[model samples]
Target: MSGVLEKIGQTQDKWFVFLDKLESRMHEICTAAVPEIREVFEQDRDPYKRAHGHLLMGLRGQINQMRSKANEVREEKIFQFIDGITSELPGHGFFTGSHDRLYTFRIACINRHNLFEEKIAFYMSLLNNAAGEQDLEAAYQEQLQAFEAIRDQFSCKQCAGQMTIPDLFFIATYVTCPFCQTQNTFIPSTGAQMVLHQARSLAEQRTAHLLKTYEESKPKNSLLYRQYLRSMFDEWNKIVPDMAEENEKFYQRLLQDHLNSINHY
Candidate 1:
């Protein structure tokens, strides 16, 4: 290859060095941020979780700064490297005869951008790991068990009749008194209400194996994906029956969109 083309290749090679430096710096930031976020989360006392929110926002801000800097480097350096390759015009490489300079530039840009994205994900995962180490899961479970033990303690307000709150309810639900035939409002604790928000996540975890199979299937089988979605939604609806209609509509729309995309092709 000509000296100019070789220089362009070497410039492309330097992208690895740039990425290595960026990743090393991201590691340092995450090393400091992760433990700090975990400490704040562990010390969290407010029901509003303002401290946790602030800490998370601070970590996200650092991530955003890193992303922005990486983007600037890609725009200034990676593109400059590709432009060097493009500068040699129609004779720089074997594929030069095809006049695919734009495609070449696109491929190089995508490669570097993908590298940056992977690093961004790695840094973000560190924050997520820190949060996951919290005792919230144990708290949620303990609160749930306590509610279960005292579920029989509630009664009908109207007739002073026995009321059985047969299931674990996240929100205030109407419990029918067996003897008086009156509906009584049963309110759960704040921690129990958190289960309402966690329903979808719990359902997803239960059906993750099916979802994984659907995701790993080649040719992107809509049937497999739909099966996984149906199972997941079934579990979600079981957890929150009030949202079944809304969730079913969402499921149908997604299925329709998937089918439509296949047809449109």
Candidate 2:
């Protein structure tokens, strides 16, 4: 049972790594395609050319929607997989009650939340870029400002000696701070407030690492990047069998649901 538990722990680590790689590849595909897609729209002006341009835009939008659905499915699978492994391991109750398991789960949840936020940023960027290509300057500016504001808010919190309750609420708008035992109320900062410089630095480092991973995985040419992305999808499909069948079915249903919506649009 101990050996089985150890194997489950190892599997969790590998699955997380796989998710990281898959996400990096998806980002690479979208990032690389953006410029090409933009250029295609820019150089075409005739009615037929315009129609083709719209088709390309639709295709890109559909792909983006699919990617978002895929991420959601992946997140669900990740949590379910973690729970399953943790459930089956030896001395389940003891392990589940362990501080280490709790800490690991908390860390995983944080990382997953951050990844979801980043994916939202990525999608917004794509929309802004597309708007710019379409010469919708006003809409593009609106979205660009919104994205910048989000970045600034995060940056402001990081730079402050101590964040006010308002700032903490802004930084983590979705979750209550566990430290202050506060819910939706701002905690006042004292003059001698503790700095989160180390935590902020660590967060920045993780962002940089993710960016570096994407850069390294990116292909030098669009054709190659597209192929790499296709390969990743194939790999994921193959590995789904190794995962829980319920998770596999969930992802498939999610993909189909998203694709159906795209078709309707």
Candidate 3:
């Protein structure tokens, strides 16, 4: 058993070395792209063309090339590494009788795969943004201020009556004018629209402890998960009080879906 474990450890170390070299190469190429992207941002005065159009074409092209190179490395090198450890070595199998060793080997492979996948995602996100960094909170606050400024400044389509929106809503909803009593459908900004979903994620964060408790349990408890889901929905409803009626229906649907997925979970 000790001999088998030693061999497996050596194989895992070799795989890690291959990953390190690949990652180093990937970083080198991506770093070379940074200056060109910065130059594009500085030179392009048309904001739309800078962000989503022609100015980004070169960077995107380079990113695709790097992605292709990484994929090729993953296929040729990663599989070869696995094959070296498991199949190509000898006729005498190391894990034929040892289930524990087999499990560990599979787990190690999965961890390495997951690490590469995350690294790829990070590179993609870094490449996509013009500034290479985003101030999400600042953007959200700016959007909120814009919404607040225009919230009360809408005219009734039916009577041309000035009406103040009573509440901030992300999605389209009927707003009744006080003077004309005409229900005008108010459409919110795209940023305001996403806030409707962001509130739910915030609620999940508030109930993260309950979720952790359920997830960390051995021989997983369905009741604990249900409790966590209920608590999360409660928090969600509290955050969006006006959406409580709609949220309740969603909560029921989510619960039923989760129940149906218990076996899979």
Best by lDDT: 1
* Candidate 1 per-residue lDDT over residues 5-124, each given as its tens digit: 555556566766777787788888788887788778778886556898888888778778878987887788777656665665665445652235346545776787797898788778
CA RMSD of each candidate after superposition: 6.0, 27.7, 9.1
Total colliding residue pairs, candidate 1:
0
Please report the candidate that would top TM-score against the real structure.
Answer: 1
TM-score order, best first, reads 1, 3, 2
Model 2 CA deviation exceeding 4 Å by range: 46-77, 89-99, 130-265
lDDT by residue (tens digit), candidate 2, 4-58: 4465466456656755665676577667766766667667664235644675566
- By summed lDDT, the worst window of 10 consecutive residues in model 1 runs over 92-101
In TM-score terms, candidate 3 sits at: 0.49
The 10-residue segment of model 3 with minimum total lDDT is: 130-139
User: lDDT for every model?
Assistant: 0.75, 0.47, 0.70
Model 3, 6-44: lDDT tens digits are 766776676667667766766776677666666666555
Error of 2 at 37 (Å): 2.2
